[model samples]
Target: MAQKNETNSAKDQSNASVDQYLAKDPERLARNLARALEELGKAAAAWTEAREKGETGDVTTAPLIDMVRTFSRVSEYWLGDPTRALEAQTRLFAEFMGIWANAIRRMSEDAAADYAAPPAADKRFQDPEWGRNAFFSFLKQAYVVTSRWAADLVEGAEGLDETTRHKARFYVDQVSQALSPSNFLLTNPELFRETMASDGENLVRGMRMLAEDIAAGKGELKLRQSDASKFKVGENIAMTPGKVIARSRLVEVIQYKPVTKQVLKRPLLVVPPWINKFYILDLNPKRSFIRWAVEQGHTVFVISWVNPDERHGMLDWADYIEEGIRFALDAIEDATGERSVNAMGYCVGGTLLAASLALMAAEGDKRIASATLLTTQVDFTHAGDLKVFVDEEQIQALDKAMSGRGYLEANRMATAFNMLRAGDLIWPYVVNNYLRGRAPLPFDLLYWNSDSTRLGAANHSYYLRNCYLENNLSRGRAVLHGKPIRLEDVTIPIFNLATREDHIAPAKSVFMGSRFFGGPVEFVLAGSGHIAGVINAPDLGKYQYWTGAKPEGMLENWLPGAKENPGSWWPYWHAWIEKQDNRSVPARKLGGRRKTLGDAPGEYVRTRA
Candidate 1:
């Protein structure tokens, strides 16, 4: 009788809190709801206007159809055998029963339940109310239970091919993430409290922001990840002093001003991926790798790729190699009077550099003394979730879509990348901006992420076919400029860096590629994801890295014997570079012989997508 009275008292307290929130501003709530509806109507109209103007493409249901077909195989495997189907159903039922019993026991004893709990790393259920409130606790546990059951079903499904199974798993995860209870208003306690406290005013503001973003996107929803207005390429972000020494249709070469009196004889050339601007390597003085390298007494030249448009649609791989890499090499030689230089590439830039090096080797040209590939993949065999979108059908569809525009739209690629980590990148922004009516905090990395670039049609198609689909680069089947080039032919010493938690280029894929290089390859594994892992500064003293014997065997085996070192890999790389060639020469000024086009951060990088 005492326990029952206690439970009733708790229920009364919850009801009183809800009543207080609802009754505080009834008139204001009604007014705000009306305003929110009006703003929502405007958002719908803007979307319709953009669609009618041909700014948005027709909705494609290909992914949904593919997901359904893939899951059918899993269903067939279970449904074909009555015994297996019964077992699967019984397991789920028993789990649900356990959760229910635990909830009952918690109500009786007024203690935490032990049946089910979210992983500690899951930020979605961090609200105290999720554990304190019985209703919310039940919802969280039920969702976790069902999602795990679905995943187990996929894992247990028999006779499914590897690709089919992989697609099924990925699609299941996507669906589960999308349907998470935390994404909804009533299901999320924090959002509910905020909505009530603001008397629905939060909804009004959110609707207004939604409409503005829709109109800004011209049709599609361009999710704002950060306050982009706070950052500018030359003034605040890419502030390292430099001057543009050379320009081509595809790229502009910017030679950074040297900080030290003397510099290494072999100037460093950085080839960043054209999918984004080059400022990622020069994001402010403190975080800028360019600034750090300049301070270390090295002449640094970076290729600032132009944000391509319809005019550059026909530019192919050969064109990027010739106009981008080779043109920069010519500019470097003229400026420094150096015949040999060290080269580094990031992400897809590294892939292109690898191809260019192989081509140079084939043509008997040896200007690059050493090569460093950061988070690059020469082999796509172990490439992560990005591979899910590279089947023949999808690639052909993408080709057809690009045929009309001449280049892939920036948002399309951005959306694909966001989908890879939708829980963190997509849904959090949705809850913050659209649900809570707040703008994202200013962040340099996210600002760069939002500053996207279009991919040339020919270049993008050739890349997808040669690298992701065919796996030709590592197989020695990749042909460039009418000549098939092999990785083993180019015997330059290589420094291969792979981030441990990279989703784009898995560490294993990078480790496997080390074996393909003919010359000595030093593989170093760094902690954290792609961006933070590579841009890590030595002073910050964050994360750790590993160095092992050579990357000959599997990563799992090599890791056991590898020595773990704390902090950034920048110093380690600097040491390795010096060991390669420690000779120094007098610091060279920008534009040794060639005329300067403009100041640093170049005009090409200033062009918005």
Candidate 2:
């Protein structure tokens, strides 16, 4: 009777504390809630307006349809046999039972209770309350157990083809991530505490921010990854000194100012992926690959691709090769008076450059001395989760969607990329920005990520069909400008750099692609993911890279024989570049014969999607 009375007294004290917090700012919270409602109405209006404007297309439903179809196949395999279905259910039920037992033990203050825990890397359940409080502890354990059970179901299913299995896993992951207890305000302990302390002002501010972001996206939620107002392109971000020496309908060739007295005779041309702006290479002086190359006495010329819109819908791969790559080559020759220049390409840009090299080889155009490919793939056999979205039905739907607008919307591509690591990229922001009502800290990388670019219908369609779907490039079946371009024909020395943790282009895929090239290939594996791995500066002395014999049978086989080297691969690559041609010439001014269009970043990058 005394213990019961003590428990009741404790409960009464907790209720009193909550009431005290609630009464602290009732009038303020009431006014804020009214404002929040008004903002929500505005957000709804913006969404409705966008729908009326036909901005959000049938593309959204296509994925849902594919997901359902894929899951149906998986379900058939399991549900067709009662035994298998029973086994799956039993497995999940057993896990839940164990979790319930553990929860009971924890509630009884049993220190020896073996509580189910989240992975150390999972940031969601970092709060002390998640482990200490019985309610949150149960919620966390239940979510973990359920998510793993779902994953196992997809993995254990039999007779499903590789693609179907892959889609099933991806879909399961998406659903699990979306349904995580951490995503809900009430279920999340930290968010719940903030709500109580602030008297719901956090939610009011969050709603206002949501409305502003929706309006900014012109209907879509822009999903602010960073405080974007903190940075600008030329003034702070892309501040590398350079001039747009030449311009075309598709690209602007920027020749960076020489920081050294003499530079390599072979002018270096950097072809960055058009999916995002070229400033990624020249993000800042400390992190800029272009600046580092210029400082190393190499005449750096970068291709600044236009953020395509309706007018660029008709431009295909052939047009990109002609107007973008070849045009830059011509401008490079005119500016430096150097016929033989070294070339580099990054991601999709690398793919395009490889194709162009094949075309150039066929036409007896030997302007390019050597080739450097950064985190690139000519083969897509192991292209990772991106393949989940690239089958026939989805592509057709995408084509229809793009045909209406003449381009794929910027946010569409951004959202797909974000989904690749939704736990890291999407939910954290959602919880922080919307639930916590805290603005994201200023991050240059996130800022660049948010500055997305639209994809031309013809170009994107061609890329998806040829590269991801057919795998034609490495197979020597890729046709360009009425000629079937073959990678084997291009005998130039190639430096292929693959990031170890790349989700976009798996290291194995890159290793396999090395076999397609005709020339001597130097395969280097860098640490970190696609972006951080490539942009790593030697001055910072971060991350490691590996160099080995020519990419042999498989990545697994190559790993044991490889020698690990410390720090950035920049110096090693520079050494290789010097070995190719050590001859140096007096540093030439910005432009020669080609007319200067504008400053380094140019007008094209300034045009936001």
Candidate 3:
């Protein structure tokens, strides 16, 4: 576990920006500030030198000029929204004073313990010192108030793209996370107590963890928060009874052992995202979507994607279509002798599914009986904050980083996504792991998150360029199977599920993407983030979901017609899917007549990123 933590730490360093790591260190803060000044001085000197030399030729001043211009633009934006900026600032200042006054009064009244009831999800307040001492509690409250104010400012910033505003808010959250009193050595009261009790051994361990991360060149700024050893393929996590009926270089098609005497005649093939393990859908006996589908009297088959490395780096988006979806179809056909199957996809897999369906439609193929897209974006125009990292500069830097690496590392991608909600995701771990010197939480989701997969360079690059940067897929500009494929040509009935709190694939964006589908579509809005929204089972009875037949207009127009449903949308989905089917047949074994390629999870899932 220690070795894995160190390995992950190193991966995190490589994944995140150097400034992000450096900002965590107190001693380095001044040094970095000085360094920034020195760079500005050099830029100024260069400009002055060029001017004095009467050089008509262009100089390397664009970066400095752009920086100044950006500052001016931001200043203008704030000035334009003066009322918003002023109101937020005023509220922040008022809250800061209000917190201190309340803390003082409570302490005097011997009610300091009440500070534990924080106004926000502030972990610092959970510390004993914060609850016992007015000083520490005040500082914690002050920080929270200030952070909210800054975030509000960003949210109300004028003359910026929605994404740019989000980017600003991202930095504000990161800064708040970084400035937490709990992350530092001296400011953190728990660290001081640990220092005296353990004779500095605890401090040494914290330093070692940080050092391991730095040396490993991975930017895991937070504790992993999950023990990977506890979860294994076909044991604890993906325990659904199944057998790999077909295998290829990039995928394994698993036809699950049926639980009923009769099953839906049409097989359901799940195409999960290659960016992560397929086992997310088959997490455990209770949480496994695959197991539930089988229990629903449906023949379930899932595509277990390979964790790509340099060996598979040359594989592209088109390769995923041919080797991933097409092969899975062939395997299901070979097993059931069925000409058509209901296909489902999650996240990027859904995007790929849409692309493949478009190409198939163009070629007059009728293999898919129905399609289900879970939190996917076929149209990138409204792709949410993820687009901030999709531009030329970021993509070029990623290309250089992945040049000889063969594939995009897990931490690199994970770190970026985690940063979108740094306050919720990153800061709590900084307090828990580094400051408290605690072990990772036994969280199944965190375990799955840490157990990330590699994205093939050719494939990921193609996806980013074609889908994200170019928006070619929606425009019918993307070429697949030597033909121009468009999303509008995809006529299969589609069920679109989007999570309300999914910063990764925003619900509105998913709603917008569903409109491009040529098929009759149904868009459902579930409460939660990307993973939780889809993995939610009916038994859990958690999170509300709203349903609407896919609309011709935007999400705003669709809301009036939509109806709300409590608990998991899984049952609702099953009912909708049943309508798309024709007949029922006797349940089949894992391998009735054709030989089984391997076991449930198969070998491809075991391959590490």
Candidate 4:
């Protein structure tokens, strides 16, 4: 009997330790669970009172109560018997799903009653009934697919230990809850709001949620910044005064230290996206494409646009071309005493470069020797979900909203992006970072996300109207310099790089530019998304390349022509770039004024509201 008692005690301790590990230590999960239970209890009490009053309906209070009860029960059950955690989680999920479904149905019915009118072109928001039907359809299809796949997984899964099985069960249950109808409405409020205008109650609720999210996001930013500064960083390259290029933003060109004072390499100009600072191309010693180009005996000069403000609100697409890009091109010409320089642009900056090229062509200027567009889009017909926000009505709304302010709000742009992947980007963080009082790790990409800049309203509005809505650039209908611009006009050698899995500009949309440009186009499909695809340096050995052989057909055919080679695209591009002429030219002043813009780089970027 004594031995049995000792064994039981040991088992309990073991179970407790396991639970602690599973929940991520003792402090966070334990207290969070307790507080959640208290909230649940309060919700239950509120529901009971509301039911007695008969003021509230079945939708609002019921789901809240159900969720609270499930959480409370799960918390209690886990505290008592850690081994039963899986069962508790499953029950919690099932109950949560049931409640969510009921709530969604109720909301749909309510929304239908409110928005039974004709669908105006401007007001053709997503229908709630349609959404409910779609949700059910998705749930049915997902379950059928998942179950078929799970049959195979479960065969191997049967051999798994108790803990692993528990986690699997928990995950499946979570999926079920996520598929609930109520969740459909909650998850896609932007879609919902389009069809059904939110009343005061919903508006207040949404504002509250947004406020909470903003607060939590700010906290996460602080933590991320603190953690990110600890990572190893590279040296800051010097340029013109006030134009100091750090490992962050690269800009300004006066006198640069040539590699050997041999002064014979041809003059080169680099064009980078203004959406982000130029340091992405010059991340570090090994990763910096600028460094690589310079090392290969080329006089490389990069253009850095001034981060715009209210004062620059009047700035338009033409201003960027004439003042920003054209100025830089001329500067490089004068600085190197060469007629033209190599130009490269990434993303929107690439689009601007193409426009500048068109302008130059119209003016009969021949300064551009070679132009490289990195993941730039000429046609945006298939620009994906981003199009949903670029409709005429929305553009007008944005124009009006920005007209008063003069600048497109950075936070607003960030919010639109967050809406794209609420599950992955927002809610998980809300649960982990805010509710649980834990800080998220600092990721370089997230650091870039935090470092956002506003756009001039005129520039942003023009881009949306012309590029996205009209699809003008690809159709050769875009007007530049008071003439219909055709990409064929600027017949320069072009190298375009696109990523396979870019969510922003899908490869198909970007690839259409190949046909648009009259120049010899060399297109390379890199592996990864927009940001990671561009930042893929030589040392990052996790990318594949496509030969761009298979004609751009469906995705499946496009896959086969693409060979899965090892190594980053950086070296591949470097090798290709080195093949170009390496004749030397003396550093001569460009056609632009030789006014010293202070020192190496400018300090205008550091100033923030």
Candidate 5:
């Protein structure tokens, strides 16, 4: 009886989960769809008239033409009689209504709910705008329903190719973005009240900023950046004492002064992601991983990548490896006279570092003793939501955009990343900077995020098509320097750190590297998202990490055998590196032959994109 009761309870929970997924906005959606169809019709007619009269070359008509065409494509999927997506939505919604009706029947009999967790979408509805009035409440709920409906509609589509599926998902997400309460003046009562409280000054300022942003960024709006006054590089951020040992078109190698007299025998070289500044590792004293590493009695050197412009647009990933990593490695060896160095890479830097190491191995070079990758992806098969924009049409559009500018603009990339977590990264700014007319708060991470980098046309296009679109990197098709590069060539032991909640490189994606390697691997599942998970120092003492033996099988299979350990994963990494084949040696002097290339944070880091 107890076993039967347990089975029944589990079934009830599963049913409740499905109900939540399908429940919450059919009538509201139908009405909106009807309203939208009417507006689309009017716009289509007007655009058709403009096109027939040869007046459609104007900006407004140009955009209207594209939108009208997009509407036609969407209609074929949603409203077409043959493969009607709307029919599926209606059927699913009817099933949900049936569930609701049964729940009502149960309520009539006073049957108690067996308690289930609320979905994340419902969390935003707790606002007074949703709860204060029935109309607003319906609107809020309706928005959630429509957003889910759009997502479900795409997920349920039949006979769609990968490219079509990708495009459809992106279009649906745009629909959700358009319908967010934060986007509208009247729909968001809180923002309307904020505008009223500010006496329309907020609207005026928002308009001014919007115009300025459109002008400066070519219709791109920036959300946040770290003020130099608040985050001075040498003084507050990247304060770890270091001297530039090597300077190249691609990188500036900074060899940090050892904090201890006796350091690890092998020198440490950190390769940060080229997408952002190296200062992220040395952000502030409290969160500086570089500082922590130096204090651990290890000689350290870091590469600061150049903020490339149109001039560097011809440089590819091969160029990045040869000019960036190889050059930096030689300098580190030249400075310290240590041929073997413990190497570390963050994000894409890690990806490149692994590739470089593999190439070096193939070429009979074993200068790199060990490697540590933090929040990096070696496999692109599961690169998360960013894959939404990786289809042929989108890639072609991006290629055209890059061709116009000679490189993929920073704002364009930032916009995509921001849209991935719109509620967290975008809508708050919309409410604060636009509605409330408030200045952006001083935030280091946001500043780093906003301080975007351009991807060279040669490198960007190649990487996008080869790695992301084709998944060539993991499949052993990525050839750099005339020879095929495989992660299996990486014989050195690896310490791979991945954040549990990293949306950029999902933890499972990082774990896939375990299957790609040729030697021992230690994969630590850290707490928090990508950045937060990495920079979390031991002092913060927040977010626990999980540990498991480097074993075979699926991510799910591995997780069941893992043990959770509290606090920062940094110390664990330090201990792991120390336990490796390292011996104590006297701290080496800073610079030698390379005529100290300016100060620690080199000229390249200060150049604004």
Candidate 6:
């Protein structure tokens, strides 16, 4: 009897163990099983569709087939439990929705579907009302329905016991706001215009273009791959190994190979914005601004901001001035043995240079002979659409998100810039690339657009809050290295250059920097937007600008001093720079050059991400 009892007790213990195992992680097992079932269902459905429709194209069937097979394998692994299988099914269903979303985004509309000439009678193409109505009716409805379905789930997340839901909601809201329709429309008015640009007689041309996009199986505007192959740093420069200062965020300083004899009397220092790589000014021999300065008989040196690491989490606007600008200035002085140098700051870098000049003036360091600000803003009151993304609530939210990450990821920064010109930056590309299935040309600007750099969380937050959102820099409330700096205190000769159509730094807003400088100042309104205006070469025929009396406030005043000049802004700039030239003083030692390293330019910039 005792032996029989022992056997029965052991069996009972084994059964209990099995039950406990199932109880411990029922949800995970359930999810796995459901996912497997979903996969199998998809596979069967695909096979049936392929057989019925006989569709074998790469675009139509390959991706779907692969997905079906993948899900099938998943289902087979968890087929034993029905509950688990159902859970997998639900998860897979959600994934299916995502796939559909992507597919719908790429689908061409009726006009885009036909490559042939569109009928002249289709007034819809001319007025854009037809195209707009068709798109909004279908897409907007789908979006509304989709959101309505997800609304309960999003709200329900709040009622959940876990904190994950709350945090997830926060992130979702941030992303949603970043992609808000108002922001999108404001940034890409061009897209709205392009689609709506056609009049009754021109309707046929617009429809045909849309149709060609569909027939070619290309997206409206494909995003070309980035080419970081052109500009190199350390390899091109004849510097000792230690002399090169590289921030992954920035390329190395450019060393100009002297080709022309009539160089400037003073050594040149070029400052670029941290948002872009320095190569914008050094793209190619013909287009390179840095090269032009070098050929002008000037000893040119540029600053390459190092890419920020997570360790730089606490870096702020003042930190950049103290470390980045101050360090570069000291190095330039040491290398060339010059006590003072002509400083040209581009965009945000110009803003920092101005602030630093103020600080330097307070300390009585007049090392800056002349200060030139290119497409920079000192005051933000008139800053236009750039403001739409930086309101108090948004900045606070961004601060919270970056608070833990230490650095703002590059993708986030790229998204913000893209939002600034949605039509130009986003939609046409969406139509050509995603919908039409074509890639963009290998253009230099396109390549640069895809290359991005990260900013430390603290630095970015401080900039948005202080400089942009609050306009503190112009207000004289901005602090640098623990000291308050005033823009008006800058006594150096100031040259403020602005682009007439620059959305980033509107001409009027950039003009304010001169008024605030309280010193000898000259303002030049260049042709085109931010980048083109700065890159305008004197020989480039497609350019013009103006320089004269300032315009009054609150005027929609793009053409306040507009004129059709004959040449690019480059030669004009050279002339302006010549006027500021002092007597050619012998290059004195500032003390940092150890030895000549190797070549004219360097290879540090070639290092890829």
| lDDT on C-alpha atoms for all candidate structures | 0.89, 0.90, 0.76, 0.56, 0.73, 0.58
Local accuracy of candidate 3 as per-residue lDDT tens digits, 1-609:
999999899678545422322334455545544544454454445545545654312212332343344445555776767785587667776887777678777845864444224554555556666655555666666766777766766666667766556556555556678887777766666665554444444544444454444323232232465755577766777888889898899998998999899999999999999988888998888888999999999899899898887889888888999999999898888899888899999999999999999988988889997999999998888787677567665666667656676677776677667777776777776655554556666777787777778778889988999888999888889988677898888887899999988988988889888778787988899989898899999999899899876556888888888898899999999999988875899998776677998788888888654
Which tens-of-lDDT digit does each residue in 367-454 have in candidate 4?
Answer: 8877777888877855755564555556776777677667765555664565455445545544334333345676545655544567
TM-score of 2: 0.96
Model 2 bad stretches (over 4 Å): 1-31
- The C-alpha stretches of model 4 lying farther than 4 A from their native spots are 1-256, 260-264, 421-424, 548-559, 562-564, 585-601
Q: For residues 25-84, what per-residue lDDT tens digits would candidate 2 score against the true structure?
A: 778767777877887888899888988987688687888999999999989988999999
Instruction: Return the TM-score for candidate 6, rounded to 2 decimals.
Output: 0.61
Candidate with more favorable, higher TM-score: 1 or 4: 1
What's the alpha carbon RMSD for model 4?
A: 16.4
Residue pairs in collision within model 5: 226-447
Per-model TM against the reference: 0.96, 0.96, 0.81, 0.63, 0.82, 0.61
> RMSD in Å for candidate 6, one decimal?
21.3
Candidate 6 residue lDDT tens string, 119-175? 466221233332333343333333333433333344433224232333333334334
lDDT of 5 by residue, 418-494 (tens): 77777678776766665555667677777777777777778788778866788877778888888788878888999
**Candidate 4 — what's its lDDT?**
0.56
How well is each residue in 1-609 modelled by candidate 1, as lDDT tens digits?
A: 999999899889989656633535889989988999999998899999987987766524456667788889899999999999999999999999998999888876767565888898999999888887777888899899999999999999989888888888898899899888898888988888888888888888888889988887777788899998899889999999999999999999999999898999999999999888889998877889999999999899999998888899999989999999999999999999998999999999999999999999999999999999999999999888888888787788778878887888787788778888999899998888888888899999999988988899999999999999999999999998887889998799999999999988899998998888889999999999889999999988999999989999899999999999999999899899999999999999798988899999899998876
> How far in Å is the alpha carbon of 425 misplaced in model 5?
1.0
- Model 5 vs. true fold: TM: 0.82
